[model samples]
Target: MIIIAAVDDRNGMMFNHRRQSQDKVLREKILSLTAGKLLWMDHYSAKQFDGCTAPQLNIDDRFMWEAAPGEYCFVEDTSVAHFEKWAEQIILFKWNRKYPGDFCFDIDVQKPEWKLSHTEDFAGSSHEKITMEVYDHA
Candidate 1:
């Protein structure tokens, strides 16, 4: 399975049960990438993609055990550490700013087994810039 999320410069994801920030351009990027694909997320995260065109699956804790290989999962509040064994890759959207956050990404992309395969930067409507990083799990 693959995972995707947006994190702040300090790797902060959310605060007070809400996303720290958002960008329309970043949302478009996600929609373009996940278009015609199966995107999985928990109930809370699902709300963020209200008008998304892709097929979305609202999942529960059993998602980790039930998701098939090659599936794509978009996570925000979900802890991704548990998916290391099954994850094929990870796509991280790095917002070029910091925000107060109670929750942060739990996985360590710096680990030896994960390789930073690609990176690209783009300006955002709500952010100065955003970097998209793709890490392949070996």
Candidate 2:
């Protein structure tokens, strides 16, 4: 499975069980990335994509365990570290700023087994700049 997440400058993803942030541009980017594919996300995360049309979505509480290989999982409150073993690729959309968060993105993409393959920055509707990093298993 391919893991997708949005993080603040400190790799923080959530605060008090809620997501740190959301942006219209980021949502569009995610939709574009998952086009023609199934994207699995828990019910909490599903609320963010309510009006989406394209890109099939599967809402399951056990999405992490249920997603098949090459499938996409948009993680919000969950700790993605444990699911690293099943991750073929990891995509992070960075907010480039700091936010108060309790749960953070825990995967050490710098580890020898995972390789940083691509990175790009774009302007977001709610944020000045958002960075994207794609890591693939080595």
Model 1 worst lDDT run, 10 consecutive residues? 53-62
Q: Give residue 46's lDDT in candidate 1 (0 to 100).
A: 65
lDDT for 68 in candidate 2 is 94
Alpha carbon lDDT at 103, candidate 2: 94
lDDT of 2 by residue, 7-124 (tens): 9988999999888999999989998898888899999999998888764789999999999998999999888888898999999999998999999999988799998999999999
* Residues forming the 10-long window of minimal summed lDDT in candidate 2: 49-58
Candidate that scores best on lDDT: 2
lDDT of 1 by residue, 26-82 (tens): 878887787666667777776766776555454564555666677778778878888
Query: lDDT score, residue 26, model 1?
Result: 86
Against the true structure, candidate 2 reaches a TM-score of 0.96
CA lDDT, every model vs. true structure: 0.82, 0.92
